[model samples]
Target: MEGDFIKINEWLKPLSWLYGCIIGFRNFLFDVGVLKSRAFDIPVISVGNITVGGTGKTPHVEYLIRLLKDRFNVAVLSRGYKRRTKGYIVADANTIMTDIGDEPFQMKQKFPKVTVAVDAKRVHGIETLMDSDKKIDVILLDDAFQHRYVKPGINILLVDYHRLIIYDKLLPAGRLREPLSGKNRADIVIITKCPDALRPMEFRVVTKAMDLFPYQDLFFTKLAYDDLKHLYNGSTRELNSIGSDEHVLLLTGIASPRQLREDLKPYVKNLTPLRFPDHHEFNDDDVQLINETFANMPSPKIVITTEKDAVRINDTKGLSKEIKDNIYSLPVKIKFLLEQEEVFNEKIISYVRKNSRNSILAKTKDDDKSKDSHNSGNGSRTISF
Candidate 1:
């Protein structure tokens, strides 16, 4: 329930060292093929982070769906973190938050045409998807950077602008799930949650600290909030309409909500925040607390939650059925402010296309060699280089 990132204390230092060594060794084992990686016949584009939560993985995954949906059959796979389910489940219009987890449900609800699947074991999830009726051309693995068992064709790593990996230590010490040197695994590194007025010098400093491998590409992005929506009825609300006299309870279960609180501070009379673990599943106990807290507040008190948490609470019945109607969710989207958006998209598209063509060429050559061997008296196959 701790809201501040600064609260991660000195005790985490030694713990972080131990965690860092474990992460490093695990990754090395994968790289050296001591541990095996599984690949589906379809390509997977993994979007994840080395650091822990709130680097904006959801938005980037959604961004990719928006960018590539028309031309490709993309299937999104996530490890339904706090779901009640035990095995892989495909997300559909009828899929409940309790079944497939909130984010996957939200994705399925948002993009009805796309395929969404969830399992703690992502490789198993991918296998299940391939066996299904859906004609999946490619897969998008959500938050799978540390999952070295599956190799993605293009690995896009997101880093928060405020919480650069360079400043973080592994696990308990700081937010990083892996060491800074693990940046070598990234194909493209995106710095998310950037300030609109960020300076060139600041960007250079981060890049220098990252010390990216020669093959890695990096970009910067920011979150752009659309008009605020009411959590109760999903009604559109103007960001400016809410008066300063309105006291509000901000309920967030995200990794970092500091930016959110700071942005809304000017408009609210008073902001009381309730924090929970990232991707937390609210139970009856949580609902009771929210109920008691809201009942004591004066009139015009509104309950606000993030979009991800909104989906999770939709099934909770502990809060009065009527009170549930009052809750609201703030929806946000990623905005890549680069001047060369088309160029960036083109680079990604071209890389995939080139790789696909090479695979086809190699297959065609193999077929020809097989035919030649069958026709020849020597019965020895020869493939031209």
Candidate 2:
């Protein structure tokens, strides 16, 4: 994980060193089964980041769901970050963001047919999902890279191009939740939030910079901003529909809104950002501020927020009809760069299809014949962290 990484928070180096030591020791416990990591017979795919903040995990998980939902009964398990209720709870029609995390709620709202459940204990969550009436062929673990309790069949690690883990330090200093060495756990690595017009040479430089193990397939993805949908009614509005003369009040309560702001810059030149901490629960004061800030804007102005933030805002009552009318959720999805979608999809599909309990090969195939250190495919290699 060596590169020309920009170092920040140099003053907190001592604390970060201590945090890294603790995290490394904890990981060691799971590494040797002292903590007892559980592996499911059903193909489990984990979409997570080494950093504490968002690395586009939600969009990528949704991508996998879209890819495999038709071919397999897909289930999503999340820790339900900041959820009021605890212990495994299955998402139903009545499920809200409070029941599941906003990210999971977004997924459930986007793909209602797919089963969604949340529990801090991922092992318990997967077991419950398996025993439920739903015939789950595969399970996707959302934000579980540090969650060693549930071993996934395919572990995908996402890195933000804007804030590469290589450029980051341990928590309380930088965004990384674990040591950079933790990257070795990844079976697939994705550098996300790439420029839409990234050159081939840039890709080569990044791929070489990553210097990933041969067993781990590398992919690049950029956020494909879609049409803005109304917060309440789900009415679609094209991003281009917002005229150049129009003002946009960007309300975001995500881990990193920098990239989102950058993306919106070309289309909406005049954007006022009302930022909030990640997973910030909305209150009446926040709502009032949003209304006031947005109302204070000139004519031909609108309020736009992320889909995750929109879910929370939708649940927050007392929004004036004016704010409701103008507030829209900008939906974003990951589009693999360099046309690597086919390769990535084939890898994901093949792993699940071969490892699925219902598959005859799953019963007959020898575990020793499986490929890679992950045993997810035809080739296996080991790399020192």
Candidate 3:
């Protein structure tokens, strides 16, 4: 399947070239001020990738939420890809996946205190957020690398270690939304899904390949898989508990399931993957098919899916009780590699502290003292590097 995809992409090189030209022209227009970009008074940090699919954007956004929620009122803004709704919608307790899209819904679920809102027009969205009663101090823009209309204070560009932009072509022929030169706009460049054991020499090679500007801070991060949690209930099980005698049916609607599959291989006796398009909304037929597939498998079998897919799956009506009982979701978190956690955390904190709209609050002696304490590792949310 992967080889076929590569061949198809190779055959579409001409289309890719055309697409690249169009994207480049659009970017040039933005750069030359032919197209106006709006900048907000408050800090707006964007976490995005050049590629069309997942490069671990959600986890990194969640990381930022964890880092800033205690110090400031953080709000996340996304375009809400594939949402049924049409306009700006702020996620609340009653909001569903269909209302605000899967990723935003998931983030809202994880961080109820932090605001999560979606709108196609980001400038309008930022305005709406600013006008809201909630005292929002900062905004995190998810998957907005190509959103040139809103100028983010800190633009973070994520690059998948396995699928570097240096080795990729434009869309249709490759996953990139724009040319590799687009990376120059980023303030920080992160290499995501890297191996924990990656050596300094390997990092240097990747750095050389990226050819990042001196102003751009490069970092590496790996996904840390947590124990499996039941989809319907709050019960948990160790990842290794699914022994070699058990049959595993992996269901995924994400762009890349290779890492999840590899993680589950050592524990399960037989692994079968049911793949779907990214952000796929589950339907009655899909649930029925899952049931049929699960029923045919041998005893001691179970179904597993990603945390993102689990959000949509749990929302599917008419899902069988048996399937619901057997299903589990694997959670993942971002772990910065080579003890760079402090560096990343300091950079983010410094940005927010510097750009906050409350100039008096940011410049006060008390605020400076508090920041000094935080720097000295005495704060409530001290990130260890």
Candidate 4:
């Protein structure tokens, strides 16, 4: 079966090449100005990847939100993949997963203070946010690296360390959405899901392989898993609390679960994973299957899933009470490796501070103050920088 799969992929290379040409042409049009790319006055930072599946985009966006929310009114805009709603829709307390997609809803639930909106047309989405009453200082575009129509102030590209674009191919044959040359478009390139203790030589090798421009900044980040939390209630448990004798039914719908599976191995006696496609919408039949699987498991067993999957599973109806009670979501965060935290923070902060409209407005206010002092018959006070 494995050999046959390889043969099939080999046969599909021609189609992948054809797909590559069409994508390459579209990018070329945008690159040379044949296709118009809109630019927003406010600082717009985009987080995305060339690959089709998860490369820790959502977590990194969340990291940015945490980094900037205290100082600026941050807003997030996404395409709301697989959402039922057609046009632009701003998330509210009443919004459901079906309204703005699961990821947006999950973000809203986690950070109620931040504004989250979804629109297929990102330009329209930005316009709507600008027209709204919310005082948005910065906009973070999620999963929009290839969305060249709206040019962002800072373009961040995420590449999975295990599935680097250098070793990947175009769609139908592999997971990449565009050619590896697309990496040139990114202003900041982050190698995501890196091992915790990456050696200096390994880092140098990856950096040399990427061959980034002098202007592009490179950073490495790894996922930091937190203690398990109950899906419904707000209870937490240590990993070792699961006991060495307990069995675990690992349930997930994300694109990559291998790392997560390995992380849970030492804690559980045995793991039985029920993997699903990325962004899978759970149905009644799926719920029934989960219930049966849980029932068949031995005593002291529990169901564990990624934080992203928890959003959809929690929304799914007809889940048995027993299943709901035992399910938990493992929280994860992006941690910059090799003590690059300060450098990463400085770069992001400097970009936003330099491009933000608020910065210009503040400068104008300072100028007005100087003029007012001059007009009031007082010598203009010298402002020390």
* Candidate 1 Cα deviation (angstroms), residue 256: 0.9
Regions of model 4 farther than 4 Å from truth: 368-385
Q: State the lDDT of candidate 1 residue by residue for 262-289, as single tens digits.
A: 7676567678888989888778788888
Worst 10 contiguous positions by lDDT, candidate 1: 351-360
Candidate 1 pairs with clashing backbones = 231-327, 231-328, 231-329
Deviation from native of the Cα of residue 341 in model 3, angstroms: 0.8
| Steric clashes per prediction | 3, 2, 0, 0
lDDT of each prediction vs. the true structure?
0.79, 0.87, 0.89, 0.89
- Tens-digit lDDT track for model 4 on 58-128? 99999999999998889999999998889999898999988998889889999999999999899999989
Model 2 vs. true fold: TM: 0.90
Q: C-alpha displacement of 269 in model 3, angstroms?
A: 3.9
Off by over 4 Å in 2: 1-8, 361-385
Question: What's each prediction's TM-score?
Answer: 0.85, 0.90, 0.90, 0.95
Instruction: For candidate 2, write residues 97-185 as lDDT tens digits.
Output: 88878888888989999998999989888888888754678999999988888888899999999898887778888888999989999
lDDT of 1 at 382: 64
